[model samples]
Target chain A: MPSWPTLRLRRQSAPAAPDKPLATVETQHGQRRLAAVCPRAAAMGLRVDMALAEARAICPELTVVEADPEADRAALAALAAWCERYTPLAAPDPPDGLFLDIAGCAHLFGTEAALAEDLSLRLQRNGLAHRIAVAGTAGAAWALARSATAGAPCTVLPAGAERQALAMLPVALLRLDARMVAGLRRVGLKRIGELARQPRAELSARFGPLPVLRLDQAYGAAEAAIAWPRPPAPWAERLAFAEPIGTPEDLSRALAELARRLCARLEAGQRGGHRFAASFLRVDGQRPAIAIATALPLHDAERIAKLLGEKLDTVAPGFGIDAMVLEAEETAPLRPPQAALADLGKPQDTELAAAIDQLANRLGSARLWRAAPHASHVPERTVRRLPPLAARPAWESDPAVERPIRLLRRPEPIEATALVPDDPPILFRWRGALHRVRAATGPERIAAEWWRRTPQEQRPETDLVRDYYRVEDNNGARFWIFRAGLEGMPRWFLHGLFG
Target chain B: MPAPASLAVLRARLHALQPQAGHGVLPFGDPRVDACLPEGGLALGALHEVGAAGIEAETGAVAAGFIACLLARLPGIKPLFWIAPACDLHAPGLLAYGLDPGRLVLVQTRDDAETLAAMEAVLREGAATAVVAEAGRLGRIASRRLQLACLKRGTTGFVLRRWPHGRTAAVQEATAAVTRWQVAPAPSTAAHREPGPPRWRVELAHARGGIEGAWIMQAGGSSDAAHPLRVVAELADAAPAPAVRPGRAG
Candidate 1:
């Protein structure tokens, strides 16, 4: 197997001053200790895990700062995302590292050594102190990139040589806990080579399976998968420009070309994308991306370009973009268009789908929908919003009952006067206008759905009963008003409007 | 060339240029109302405007019902697009006007610009049989664009002039609509002291090449029956009150 593993280690420098010896200290058990030290501090004999007071005495010029592990992790993750320009399988390995699975991608950069050199050169240009190592296994590359035995900043171990390369490294490089390393050292096994020479059954029986599993992983006898930060898209197309382009026209032209290529691939596989995302990688390391979703699966290049073009203005080309990547984040199977046996001159389904896609992309998908009838007695709960293209559910309105043409989002409270307790209001004041009822329809009692009510709403005093009335005012404007509660003074509310 | 012969040739050329002239018309199924229109029906592949009259303009309930009835009268089972600034239309209520709720694609846009844009897009797609949009104001240029889009796809478009709550400024701007209507709720004739079928005082304020008229129209007979909005009586245009006012006993 052609196994290619890439390991990246970044040594964070103090942001204040690079020349001043700096040490980040953290409180542990009521005593502050050095969590990390800069290169200048290390050269001045200040070490991590040393007491902050002792370090200050050893190097009085040492600049002390509080350690922020969370920010460091977030910055590492962002760097990993930026590294996707090289390979989509780049993942953050936490605290201060990244793992890039560039197995088949090395040829694009000429060779494995050249790819590592390019990566390190870019890191150096960005003023980051980093070490990169390539090996046949992730465990071996990770160990070699951090160990002092590599002798060089960038190391490339050929395939099948991980066993020999990792033998001379200390047991600590096996990714074992500090207690386990100390225990192994007490047993006279200070190096991985000595541990490999010992009987595996005896070593595992003493230290459990962790040591054996990690040792096997480093020697390429087992596998270690990097936990990717983001799931790789099923289909993606990337373009790198010889000269950076920053104009809107150039960006849109590039996007259209990428979309055309992506759609062609989707067509060949008999699939359509439901969601597409385009990422523009700027020279200054800013990755601005825009995404669009369709209501129906589509593989049409022009349609995808049109939808994405509307959002091109939102992408800011900071210092010009050097590369671009388009990915189909979601896809589904769709057969190519075929001639129907009988064309009835009706608009094809795709025409509606295209219109829906355009509107949804611009105004948001939630804004467009088809109303479906829900099986509930409550006026508001009786209707449900469904996706525009969803299959229409069966709906049958009861002609015997009258429903208002316009239902208010919320019922507005009104003052009313009635002759009887259960009778319709003779006069009602709504929105500061009094309407004398000329004609009326009876009390259509719609009770609250007991089964759907929550525990807090099930109280007796909360009265969810309503008696609705269809009343026509003297001006001929009809309204659907209701009285809440079954007892005491009736509370009236105007719920809907009728023609 | 003879004068009569030359005039006939020019008329034919004009008709040929107007695409909607060949698309036919949408009849209200009532002869009295259809007679006021030049083509004996509302022109297809054109834009129409409907606004609520007087105090009823605030809610726009009556105007929405009139539009729903017109959409129901359209021939075919094709889907209808309804674009509005807010989604307050109760689907169940539309059934009363003979419009099936299942045949509706409702789009709630953020503002007037989005509503008009969505309407134009839907009309140009030619997938929907008709499109109804509730916008507070319609400029002349925007309405002309909507009409042109309809002409391209032979889709009918209706713009309902509606404003937000408590803001009842009337829309006075002229548009390129083939017909303009003002609908007000009229008192229904009481049947045994109960409210009968809803009535509307519908006024055809403008028609492209037809005479303007006003009528007191009642919406259908039975709830299940497809009552093609029948006219009860024609108004004098100057009269404020009809003869069928219910007595206020309270």
Candidate 2:
């Protein structure tokens, strides 16, 4: 049998305790003394759920405000980001929950219960109601916390040990339909322990795959991966808080621990990541987390912390936070050391890169990029824009033939009404401006490569030649102009201007 | 008590923090392009550029594409930054040649002028080997100012000029840039042929250490050295008959 908290707040964000609700306290002045008021509270003479209007008749005034889900989400995300200090695999469970995969990390954290106690104490300090449970499988832990609350020992099942681990958690932990649980109840199966003794075939025959699946999850037959509110982030560190943190400094220090771990991983992999996420969990059943993503994948602790700190103002911990998570997404291989001893060290590159990363994190990744190279001869086609720090370039990978220092995206047609047909243009009109050719150079005839030209590039053989000329304008400023025709015969076009 | 020159050199070397690339770091390819870089390549630091006449706002010519091509020639697994103005930078065409957007940083600024100043500051940081900026006009003093900054940080900066219709741009005689180039759209043949990259007619207008105009080289593509660049007019071109002695035999 399940018991909803008989006590409810006159106004509560979520349905107070679906499995075992929390006692309602309208105005909490101290930790131990929570003035109770609710349906069950009324029955107990606490009268929590009474309308402020009616409660005023019963009592006097009640504070009511629409729940800010955004705040809750931010806080949770901030907690998750903070959790990154422990492990990168942190995610918010939603409404008010967190899913941290501590696989292979139990020893590092000492023990799951210790980790849990750590969370509990932190939440208590933050004035939050934290119900933390660790189980062999996410389903088992979820079941244990939601179905079996308060002092119900969280059974740890060893590898291939879900059956033993989840045997104690109630069947309700499986989250089966109420009708199914009722049906099972009618059949005299109540606790998870009762169902565990039943044959799998009978359970399958009676409840279908769901029962079988949940049983398997509880017993390690199959794994139940929790559907995280956000995608599972890649993280390698975790810090279980001894005391929940409310200030930015505490949050920063916690994040630093995770950052250090991440830096180690990055150094080992010889890679860096631009986009990073940090999540936090508050103790007040409110989950507010912050995610900081950068434009460039970076590995400096101070810079990253500074960036996250800039966004700290955006996070409102409401009450306080218990745990924090930080993880990195969007990674690239580390740059090979190309340091050279020049006269003095320049901070521009690193500073700019860092600034860009912060801006990219604040803006969407799509908005920040570096110009990329394209193959098209068209000036515009030759240049591409891509996300910053997103590539391992092949630019310096060959003995390249000397290329023109000047390359334009599109050819500008010039009006050459006055050039002899058989020579480089001595004069031409372009962009409604006239340019007189001062010192003339021979036409460097460029023909399109036939083997590679597609139908898009096919033209009559006669127009195949491009007679280029380096003509110094009367102003002594040079212009690279070309004529689309045979030697001497020219159709002028202005290409590039020399600076 | 004068320190020996060797000792002074050793001390200088010892003070260095960021280690230099070992011989094994032989650039994967394109050593020539690397040769021009401070660390035999774009150093793992900042680079900057200054542009004038709203050049940064336009196709990002002075500020964006130039850097893309320069970086494209290197093959290390690092990132590049196109710090425009803390805003306003697009890189679609850049990826066609394989510069991943994920490895780029575009800092679009609110305006063109501000972007240049910020770019100078970024270059002074020394962490990046390059920084490019676009300003309304980089006069001699301004170019000199930026050049000094680049020299101090061991970074390189490219200043772009936007010359309006028929109006000549002001040229700065003093600066640290070893070369100045003007990028414009290359000419294309109207005749049908296998399509190829748009050919650019490079004009080396200025150079400090190397011969001016010596840098005029063709944009190498799928062609070979014998036919390094396209020479058009096959049908209409009258080839000089191969020089041959009149056949005495008869």
Candidate 3:
């Protein structure tokens, strides 16, 4: 196995267990003893340095863990996922430090201390080695964590007491290299307070400028930041279950609540999010979330629920989820509904959306898309998918030019026998049946979009330039056909038929 | 002298949505056929047709064929619907009769039973001016139910018959229709001057509103290229017994 770069857990192993084979290291009792004799002692009295065999002589039973730096990192990642339920800002405790900004939520649980206690308790239950500290400044919190009395929370040093609060901590807590710490210790620097008192230039010259700068952050003398996990996105609404949800119905009910809340929030802000993300936070500390992204922004709760329902199959609530949260991402200007009472008397947007939503559920979402014209002549690029959250648009407008009422996404190729290079072919075969062209229109030319294309565009995958024609066969049947690439020799494909 | 108020009121209510009252109001396949329909036109909802005709036996496409000819002359942009449960309605054939595809909606369904029901539903609530469903003979109750539906919606209901195995549950047994025509093969077209596909020869087996029997007329076509896919319908007074028999061998 490849050994990865890791934080050294300890200098040596602890004493061995009396009952089990694996050995352990000694703690502050300072004498070697079997780990089985008192495992609790290993947690407390064991020193960071003590060879395994030497400690085994004092206590025979000890359990040793071959250090797993990788697992530790993964566990921290899982912790991050768990934290995502609370806020979008959950991240790894970088190099063994977790910084959380629970600013507006302090009063939600009564006080910052209560929030910390709740957070610490949850972490403990999930088997995490965590200690939380909150202060007016990031610097104060960082300094207080390693400096405060053991087993106690952060010491909230008064505004001027930053230097005093940091004074007693060992220089090891200053986050410097061992060589620098040893060098500082050898030169009569006893405590962090002593280092703080040294002349600025002298310390910079003697121990280097980095340590002094870090010290400033520790003492709240300089501004510090707790880098958030991911950027706090647009809108998020959370639902706390009075009774935890285990059934899909329960989850759906929770979704309705979140949709209403989120929609209202969007309405109040006069905005709407194009994407709706619903997260089900599992009791096992694993969050499985599913999101539906619309091509448009809408706040209709029923529509939102339907879109989310389209994706509900992806969420497997293993055992059960204790809470559910919904977040809206990528917001846009909210549209005031213009549908009149005349429309309400008939089938409305809600009904249409519901019907389309049902069909969309049966057919895959990708299969359900409406297209509108774009500013491109490249036929494929000339149309784009209308956003799902948007209302249906009118089909006809002023005719700047004649356009086909029917258009096919992909032109179906015809099996050709009679070859005509210059003009529309007199006969074409489709669906194994022959159609003889009787009346025909022009071989209209459309050039390639050269300016908007790249090197890859030079070689079209199908490599055909198209000149379209409206042809009525001998049978009075109308067909939309095309001859490829206008400027030169073109191929043919039967595109569509007028219905 | 003005008609009495009570008498005028009686006449209006009696014929409200009555197809007989609307005769001569609109054009159908000759006024004779139009007078027979309750709506005096194709029932506007959804119409279904099932073809049991072979190229040698031209009568199979008769019901659908008749409707197509009638609808071809329909004016305005009102859309028409034609549904078939048997997958036998040909699109090109419809276009041959001059029914505009833009204004005509075609739907293929599973079987006569489903198609009949679907067509009935569409007729009840849709914009189709005609509802035609094909079934093996429709039972009296079924015909009455369909008739009531058409009457309420001001639609024309045509229960196009298919060859049933037994004493059918057909509209013939269900109600005395305004007109019931027996359609069969006619002689080859003198214009085409070749052995060609069978053409229909129609005979009026029953008619309450028009001549009971008449000369069978040729079904017409407009030749762009002269599709040559034609069916001839000439009216006759009392069709041959076997011709009117439900599903009897020709």
Candidate 4:
């Protein structure tokens, strides 16, 4: 368990003075109180939830800073992400603590006690005051880490010893609310051992079922689920260095090795990934990550490395990185490999898919698309964008209808005059230029889809009925113009340019 | 001065020195137009530049349509990449030129740099049969890079010059493209004062080993999708001039 607010202040303040005390204050129940205190302040008879005025009176020189729960939570979450270097199963225990499920990962650092010691030392070096307790279950570890009776800063409870170890701690360490703790104390139950001695039925009848459930959880008799910050990747490869490496060449080499290993694993499983993320853990506890996505499922190492190499410059090695982890976040089963025959005239589908991926990863997937025809009479609504490799149906269009090559995103209003109420324009002025219409085509009337209109457009005057015309100017430049509205001062607009 | 056998060897060497000599050609299928080109058609595995004449260069509608027709003539069902700064090409309009919208992969970029980069990448990949890019400017070095990429994979590239903001002096800068053209809308020969098929004044402004000429070209009728563009008449003032061979005075 980490005291987040003061830890954050300590981390922010450079070369913190040892004798000065620090406390973070917040308004609780309409009264300002100390939400968290540093070790010096705690030693000076100050506690969390104590009145701010009372704390100030006792220690007039206390460094009081306003508490920011949001910042503290964010810092805790970052720390949890950094802790992924220890185990992939790390989660932030809100407002203050972190939970690391290092069941099988302890062997990497030698033993559970050794791993706890290493974590505690690193936290201390980073200017954070924390308690590390390793146990058979998450609940037992969380409860033990917050208890003051735990002897050492790094406590490792042996298997099957949670009940004995938690007997003497206060019942509040079981994560009970203040009201429940007060109710339990009113019944002369001040310790977890006293609460656990009572019969389950009696305890449920007296203080509800929470106390019983919590006690069972602490003893490993019931499951305690932890919400992981990120779902563990299905496939991952990690590389740890004995000394920190920061040069670009070293990072690229490490990344290449990791990609090779990961791709081998994927090949063995007959799987390919669409999304891959690589995270670099720095010695200063910063995790810089870069992710790349493919247009199709891919398992080739060279292509993956090339795609990731384009983004390798973005990672900043602040104090030098010590570990790197590459994970495949999204994966799918791939088809079995087939031997190649003689070279055909047509390009392979994989070659096109690879090209699409290269461009999509650099310029974004939305920038690349294939056009698919839509069934609509409205010119703008006649086409939609689809993925580059999507199988599209044949596009069928009327051979007689002439459409402009380039369609403006929006229509520009123009001034035009005609001889009749519903005829093509004889003259028009567009973009500050006047043009005499040399020849004109019919008024292809197009009405707005009544079913697509909203209630606000239900008025009669708001109707959008357009009479489209393909007209040519004296200079031989053709334009697609439309006359909008059925009555009263019709308006002309230039919508497209003919080739 | 030389033996007959040595003359044959020298002729083979001359052919080898010609750019994209054996890569093949895509003819306009009109003798009037093809006669002006040294290879009787547009050279494959090379870069070509197309721009609209005068102020019409801003929209580049005519140049786009011309490139679409060229792409439709490319001899395979391989994919085609059309890279542009904006998504403005109307799919149905491309169908009018016999180019299928289904075979085109449209890539929209933020600026000219990205558009050129995508074009080079696609050309280098060698998978696509052709690549058409709509860009505002192409310097000498960029065009050379695109030409080299096309040469590597036997892919043809077309650069349609469009100045969406306004025309600038960059339009006149020299490039390494094999051919450069300028197209302007021309009056259609329709009866009874009605709009007819689209027509353009197509000018072969520059070619490596061909004569300069201009002609009145008209798009094919609605029924003729296979051969969509035909040369109607030649402009007397812009008629075919003498071929300007390399290292030779006019």
Candidate 5:
């Protein structure tokens, strides 16, 4: 196995509480005990698993805060997100640290040494005290970053040199629980080198399989891959300038150039994209991104540039933008546009796409929607609201039946006068208005959705039938009202109005 | 004297502004109705105002139905956009007027401003063949904006005035609309015995570069009928003759 460039950040929780000798205490067995100690508390000889009383006695001025494992986890996750600017593969090293795979990214900062130096300088400016170590293996890097002295804060081990790095670190650095460390200590093993000297079979038999597995991982003899915060995006292009750009004209020019380059690559690959996002990395460490989506697949650089230009006002060029990256996150296979005849007029399809893209960019994609027909028998559920570009079933309308030009969001109850128990209404009073019926017709019954009811040994409680009527008032007003429920004691509601 | 010379120059400029050819008119296919309109038909790239003859729901429904039928009769598969604040329209009633549910796109806006904006956008984009909007309050500036947008693309627009509180005063206000119409449900024909078709008395109150007249029209017929509807007759208001009674002077 060869070496992998891994960066580890250790003691990730202490920077949150600067200027305080903090000791995190937890309630174990109904008694307070120290879970972890910060650097200042550690300088006072406070230790993990020490009783709170003993720690208080040792350092009377110590600040004791209850341990929050969740907060520590969240801080590590945020750090991992920040580290993504350096490498695509960045993951939280659980309760306290982060692991970054920067194998090919070191050259971006000129060299590995420069990368480590830059990281150190940035963390210092951010008020976070970190001990970072770059090693050939994540396990070896983790062990070295935690146990190595302050003078050797940034340790870079050569390829296949994990054995030597693990040999110098303590056995406790192997990520073992307290019982495993105590078992190894009882067996007279104090360092990783001592454990490596024993036969592998004998070591496993004495301390279970964990010690051998941990040693193999740290020695670069086992498979270990860090789980990144998210899988890498399919396509991304980034440009970093020597000097930050502040003017809108320059920004627009740069954006057009990037669009051209990205579209060229997409053309070469025979692909088109519906979603394009450009992230502006400001010098102040604030990332502002603008995303534009088209209703149809498009790869024209000029069109993309125009759409992005419309959103340039939203990107605050605060301090100045030092770098910009463009990504075609959602893409599809390109279909060649049909050749146009001179007398055929402009291609209406492409014109519609351009107009839709412009409107969606301004009004938001949610505001531009189309009603799609569904197979449901329920009137309201028969049509669904969907994005404009979403594929919908062919509209099959029953013209023989009458439908309202507008349907109320919900049916409103109305008082009505009827001749019989199941007959149509003669007159109705709605919204505090009484109307005399001039003519009336109907009793169009729509039964309940019986398929929705399961085979329960019960009555038809889930099924309610409706008897609709079309009536004209003496004032020449028409309405579509319905009687809910069946037979006796039914309620009348105004469902919709007729033209 | 200066205004007349400037008006002549403005007329020349306006003549130059009109698009070439007659590709924008939509004929009603009836001589009585089409002859009363400029270009011998309804013009695209313009805003038209439609309102009920009375404040009753039946009259408003007839007005809306007439526009719906007109939009459906256009020679294209393009969709129709109808923007309104409070659409008390029955979907089935629209079908009775010959509009296909598949070709309909409804936009229920919250206020008159949104309605106007949506109408303008739809017209400017030419995404829909026609945009019909129901508005309670439409200022002059908003109507001008809609007309300009309609001119950008040869899209037709219909502004149906459905004033709240059943007020008809807004119908008489000065508007930028190229045409104004009033629709009311007329008495049905008696000889058919069965419910023949829905009839309406359509009055062309205002028209640009054309004359105004009133017509009696039918909108629908039975399943076996050849045509959906037709213009049955044209109406003319008759002047009353002076009376010479025994006790009164003529």
Candidate 6:
């Protein structure tokens, strides 16, 4: 089995300038105090929780700044995202640190020692003061990273060597509170080795279960799972600019290149993405992203670029964009088109589908719709609206009934006179004109759904029975008119039109 | 001098050498109506306008039914998209005219411009086989754009002119349609009319390379009952007497 090499960053909150004695202070119990101290401040005989006035008295030139934990957390998350270049599994260990599970990636940099050295060199180039420790378990790594001497800022412990490696580290490095560390020191257990040698049940009964759990975790006896801030997409590509690009054309060019690269990766995996999102990282700390969806899964870079181009105006590249990343938000296994000549006729269909996807991408998807049939006798409830690409409704069960071509939005009232109560209208005045009914069809009775109506709704006005008539006027015009209400005085309303 | 028989045969040969007459035409299944068209039938992959012969609700209803019957008779399985200003299309009514409720996609737009835009998009994408759009006043450029889109993807387009109220004349702005037809409701053929097959006075006002003509036709049950649009009669230039009335024997 392969070993799990866990790496942790210590003193992650330290400022960029290590030469100055910089200390971050926060209000503790309404009193201004030092929350954390840099290495220079610590070397200058100042410690954490020291009062600002006392620290200023100790070092006349001490620089004290208010603690901004939010900024520190943001820095840690950005560092974690940067660490993804080395290993796919990188998590932000908050309040100022990062965790990298670099198991199999060590070989890419020659050796584990070399990988740690490379990471140290890169962090140093970025002017970040950090100590990195690699071990078989995260707890051991965390302990060693925090307790390492200033001369050696990087350490790598071989697998199963966590106990020996951590033996010299102090109990405070075990991530315990100040009170717990003071209690452990008072009990004559100053080093991690002394704590580990104590009787387990006694230690649990005295100092509670946390110290014991920490020791077990350090020695690889317990499990530790790191929660990553943002899970890395399987297929993603990034393009970084030395100088930020401010022009829309340049941004488009950069996005096209990134999309092409991502499409290449997707093609290698024989997969297609149904949805893609492009994020533009601006220099002024704004990250704007645009996402587009396709009806058919696609891996072609040009098609993706086209869709993205349509939405380029929506992406605001304020100040300037420094880096752009394209990620496939949703993907599926692609079934390549068959090479047989018999299937050649389907290219037109494919073209049509692509065109539709483009239009849907440009206009919102909700704007494109299909008609769906409903199983209802009500004239208005017989059809439904669906997306354009939905499957066709079943045709075998469609009843052969005579229906009008165009239906009015609502039944418009008209004056009509019939020779008999049951007979069709002989003359009607609709839209202020009298129409002499030259010929007419019978009254097709359509009853309303009584089961849906309540007892209170069974009023004379809510009478829902309709007798539809297909009538033609003297000037050769047809109408689908209906009569509702009572038989004694039926109210006539025009409902549909037949060309 | 050429002999009469030889001259006739020579003319036929010349006509055959020209571009195939019925290459892009969709037959109406009625020879009498097809005979009036330049291509022997309705031209496919082109725009056609349908409107009421008179400014009345009943005439508009007849025109709508005529388009519905044509839509039901369209070949293949491509879905139909109908764009209108409102949700005014009656699905049940269309079903009675032979258009399946399932095959119809209704897109309700806010205005005439949006309706035209949606129709153009549907035609250009070729996502739908046929598109039927209702508009108030379609300009020449807008109709041309729709026509061009249809020609690009071989889509059939139907533009229904829903005349605005209080206007006695139809909205007749010049358009880019291959055929312009006006259909009015005619009396049923059966005496003591028991709701026999529907009849209409169909007038072909515009056809490329063809003279305008008018005819009276009837829709009856054909082999394909799902789309039973047949032209039953061909009226002369002179008006014919009212053949039958509703409650009286002819």
Q: Scored by CA lDDT, what does every candidate get?
A: 0.83, 0.52, 0.55, 0.85, 0.72, 0.74
lDDT (10s digit) by residue, model 3, range A1-499: 0011111222122234333434323344665433221223344444334655665554445455544446545655665767654555666654456566666766767777777777777765543444566776565566566553645543434456767666877776676778998999999886888888889898999877877877887776775655665567668888766556788787887898889988988888988787677888897778888877554467778778867876787888887788787888688996777878666554334433443344344333544344444676655565455544344333333222334323444677885433457666778887556887665666666666667565765765334457777665554445567776655445578765432
Q: Where does the lowest 10-residue lDDT sum fall in candidate 1 chain A? A: A1-10
Query: What is the C-alpha lDDT profile of model 3 across B1-250, one tens digit per residue?
Result: 4579878888888877454333122334454444443445333422222223322122235555655655655443334445444433433344445544344444445556655555555455534455456566555555555655655555555556764223333234535334555554344333322212224445555543333343343444344422223323434444343334453211
* Candidate 2 error regions (>4 Å): A1-174, A177-197, A201-213, A219-222, A229-234, A238-258, A264-324, A328-408, A413-416, A419-433, A439-469, A482-492, B1-134, B137-250
Q: Which is better, 4 or 5, measured by TM-score?
A: 4
TM-score of chain B of 2: 0.56
lDDT of 6 by residue, A1-499 (tens): 0000001112444433446777778899988898777666778888878898899999988767777777666666776776765676788887766789899889978888899899899877665677888899999988877774525768888899998888988998887999999999999999999999999999999999999988998899988767976576888887878798888799889878988999999999999999999988776546688999988888989889878987899887888887788989999999876677875543345555665676567556765676666777767666677776676564433444566656676778999999988888899998888988877876778877777775755554424888888887766567788899655688898877665
Candidate 5, residue B60: Cα displacement in angstroms equals 6.5
Docking quality of model 2: it rates as incorrect
Query: Predicted chain A of model 3: TM-score relative to the true chain A?
Result: 0.64
lDDT of 5: 0.72
Best by TM-score: 4
Report the TM-score of chain B alone for all candidates: 0.84, 0.56, 0.62, 0.86, 0.80, 0.78
Q: Native-contact fraction for each model?
A: 0.77, 0.15, 0.00, 0.77, 0.26, 0.63
Local accuracy of candidate 2 as per-residue lDDT tens digits, A267-329: 788878766676676665454556666545578877777777767877777677777667776
Measured by lDDT, the strongest candidate is 4
lDDT tens string, model 4, B42-66?
Answer: 8888899998755577888889888
Which sequence of candidate numbers ranks them by DockQ, best first? 4, 1, 6, 5, 2, 3
lDDT of 5 at B46: 80
**Structural similarity to truth (TM-score) of each candidate:** 0.87, 0.47, 0.54, 0.88, 0.77, 0.68
DockQ (0 to 1) for model 3: 0.05
Where is model 6 chain A poorest over a 10-residue stretch in terms of lDDT?
Answer: A1-10
lDDT of 6 at B240: 28
| iRMSD, all candidates | 1.3, 9.2, 11.0, 1.3, 4.2, 3.4
Compute DockQ for each candidate against the true complex.
0.56, 0.10, 0.05, 0.62, 0.23, 0.34
Which segments of candidate 1 are over 4 A away from where they belong? A1-15, A149-152, A159-164, A193-202, A335-347, A419-422, A450-464, B1-22, B222-227, B238-250
Error of 1 at A54 (Å): 2.1
Measured on C-alpha atoms, candidate 3 has an lDDT of 0.55
